[model samples]
Target: MPVLLGGDANVYGMARSFFEAYGVHSVAVCKKALPALAHSRLVKTAVEHPRLEEDAVFTAVLQSLAKAHPDKTCLLVSCADGYTMQLARCREALAPYYRFACPAPEIVQSLGTKEGFAEVCAAHGLRTPQSVALPCGAPLPELPFGWPVIAKPADSPAYWNCRFPGKRKVYLANSAAELEEILAATAQGGYRGAMLLQEYIPGPNTALGVVNAYCARDGSVPWIVQGQVLLQERTPEGVGNYGAILTEPARQDTALLTALADLLRQSGWRGYANFDLKYTSGGEPVLFEMNPRQGRASYFCTAAGANLARPLVEDLVQQAAVTLPVLRPSVWYTAPWGVVRRFCPDKHLLGRAASLRRRGCGTCHLLAPGEGPARRAWYWLRQGAYWRKVFANG
Candidate 1:
């Protein structure tokens, strides 16, 4: 019997590492067209609908996998919210055919939405940024806090919009007027979802991003790993642009991470998830946000030491008891060449290329040498061309 891992291709790095570590064969189902650089032999299947319609697509995909591999143990690990929620909803029908690594539908829903999760965090005394939600069409909330506050849609479009090819917008406002202006622009642009206006927490040069793995049945926190802060950059709108540099564990940060882990255990969250956080001036760690699915940094964790995906697969397929690894402090960096091209388009291409050459960080580009240079070149060229158009208009 074989194991099938299905979800967005964004998780290919982690998924691939896990499959290899466990010596298991699997397939990846991407919501969009298959990437040209994917492993030659990894089965690639395309969904009928885009990411927002992942629920419908995944239900169909699961049915197909079940029919195609009835003799095998199919483990569905959703790396996107739409797929996660959809899988939970169809748990009854799919459970009889395949194993799923997710919490119950109600539990997932409770943690999926910002409002719902915020309420839970408040009740549990977790430290989250000060937040105020405004009704649609209403004036923005009074700015009780000062400048450089972060504002974003409380409900991320990961489920509703997926990753559309465009200049994504997430805002950081230094004044109430700025916040109001951005909200107005967003409303005018037809965004009607609930949004959060939060106090932005600044920290030292180094901060930790914690990824925890837990057991769903007893809410047992099994693994807590901390990734070193390499470099963090944000768009003008305050959305995270690049995360580079992952290093060995920081003990102080891990204690704070463990505290949050205890909270998740009490809340009955299971399977896999991550929390983004920063330490305050007083050295208190404050919560930034929670990802109810596989964190984008999963690859960094796998590359650094522990393979998160392996346990997830084992838990789903064999209900196996697993222990986590004592991962050494290691360094990870996003592909410098890609980051420069992604964020610094105003500079000359030659200058950007030079800057990347000087950067010292882990290189994990979707397209790198010995893998598929031609395909990587094509994808970046397309991305560069798209950005060129935006800058030309500006």
Candidate 2:
């Protein structure tokens, strides 16, 4: 009986890769919008319900799969927060039919809200940006920090109708006036959820590292690996996401990993989760956020030698003792031309090109050769359009 994996198509790629590497048979069920003939068995379902409507869609999909393959033991892994929460909401109905791999519902809820995670970090004596939360339609609060403060929603797109229009969604407000203007615009755009007003911390040359781990049924952090983001491109409002390169774990990443493990243990986190952190000027790790599911950086982390998805699936299916992988130091670069041409037109772009020219990093576009030429062309075209949107707003 092949394992059943379902979620956003973005995650299907990694899940497919994991099963392929392990020589395990599996099937992928993805949302209808991003449809492709599943090179493997594919089930198309509607996965675009608003937060409140997600549980119904998930339950429908699972019930469909169970009826089709009664002999298979399903293992559910969700990539998006909305889907994860929906699964948790229907845990009683779904868990009996499938093995669900996710952090505790409370932990997922806590990490889903930026304000909630900040409070958790503060309670643990972890260093986080000073933040203020404002409800929708409320008057903008007085700017606590000067210009370039970080502004983002506390609940992401879970509760808000407005998607980050462009890079302006998450801003480095240069002045109180700029912050107020952006806040007012965000509120007027139907952003009714909580928003975070935080002090900006700069690390221009810094790489964002994600530390992901799988906790045992008893809540022990058994498998841990860290990977660095070589390149990142986000919308101004921070809603849009783009390609990233996975690289080998950095030597400086150990302390941060330890700190995060301790923090999650203290918070009673179990199952798979990731931490987004960057080093400060003094080499101290600063917590940015926690993702209680597989992250965008999961690809990079797996490419760097630790296949997080496999261990997660193994734990969920077999309940076997987990072990971490020994990863080598290597670099992965993503859609460099797009990133360079857009965000780093001057120094950053040139610097990356020069580095690649010097054989300092390995590069691969996410689109693979096995994909149809038409699909590949469409992907690049869509990618070009997204970058254009980012720059036009800039």
Candidate 3:
């Protein structure tokens, strides 16, 4: 069974994915009981603890859980950055009992930060948003980019550790004073890492591209999927999370796909890796960042007929050769149709979404087989709440 970390839509999606493949339930360790995991048949165990992100507490929970269930092989999977880093750091201690699907500790430290990822992309031929990484608590340096730049902490886990009056996952600074204000607030929150000030590419959410790939034990990335986000979560906390994807290869930037595959192959990265990118007006895809594990919306790959659960099981559990096809032309929905329509104003994609559903090429992560009444209600309620949040923000 996969011992997943963090309780959210992504973890539930992963549990459902594992259940669909092996007809077995998985375990989850989260800080709170989120709606997605409530009354779900797929999640056999949901462990909640406040200090789950702390190093000692994280290891103890898994080690205790492993001792409790020695009959089954426990695979450690992370759905959040803190868990992913902690799992990679504590791999040696947990190797005896639990199996891991994460990269090495060094790789996690090297590429986990935005500046570190920018360095890797620069070494390769990948295009990224032209900006600078300025050290926090220092005098704000002259930015290479213009006034309207994207700002966020270079490190995710570090940023999550601190609290402030108004802390966002990302910020768009339309002026120099706004940039200074964001940086000041971040430094005041006790984040000592560098801040990522990147060029803000202009486009609707539809211009964003998402990639999901899995590299096996051997240095081979057999499975890959590139998707164009049709609808995105518009709230501050949920920004950059893809709610609907249109996996039409014609619209996706293939060069980004090739560069990413090469990055995984040459870097010797194993397990699932997902990339977030935005397309420039010149039609080039600029990479935003990378997740060491599969992203929150990875179920889109499963919906596109390229199930992500099979490859990991084949390579790790079965020790068999793994090969799979890419995603076909389809619209994968993880949100309700009303929510997707409410957030996405593009007439072209709205029409495409409608036509695709009529022809039966549309697939939903929540609408899969075997969902119970409670989960069914949570799905709609969660989407409704998300819709209201976005509406209020506007």
Candidate with best lDDT: 3
Off by over 4 Å in 1: 1-9, 23-26, 33-43, 50-57, 158-169, 233-238, 250-252, 337-370, 376-394
TM-score per candidate, in order?
0.80, 0.82, 0.92
Clashes per candidate, residues 3 or more apart or on different chains: 8, 13, 0
lDDT of 3 by residue, 1-394 (tens): 8988878778877887888778889899887757767878888889999888778888888899999987998887788777888888888888888876778877876676677788899999787888788887777777777868899888787786787876788888899899889898888889899998898899988888899888888889887888878887666676657778887656555666677889888887878888898888788888999888888888877776677788888888888888675556778777677777777768788788778777887877665568788768877787778677767978
lDDT of 1: 0.59
What digit string (tens of lDDT, one per residue) describes model 1 on residues 340-392? 34544334432433443456434452443343555567656745754454455
Q: Cα miss at 166, model 3 (Å)?
A: 4.9
Rank the candidate models, highest TM-score first.
Answer: 3, 2, 1
Candidate 1 TM-score over all chains jointly? 0.80
Highest TM-score among the candidates is held by which one? Answer: 3
Q: How many backbone clashes does candidate 1 have?
A: 8
- The lDDT of model 3 is 0.81
Evaluation by TM-score, superior candidate among 1 and 2: 2
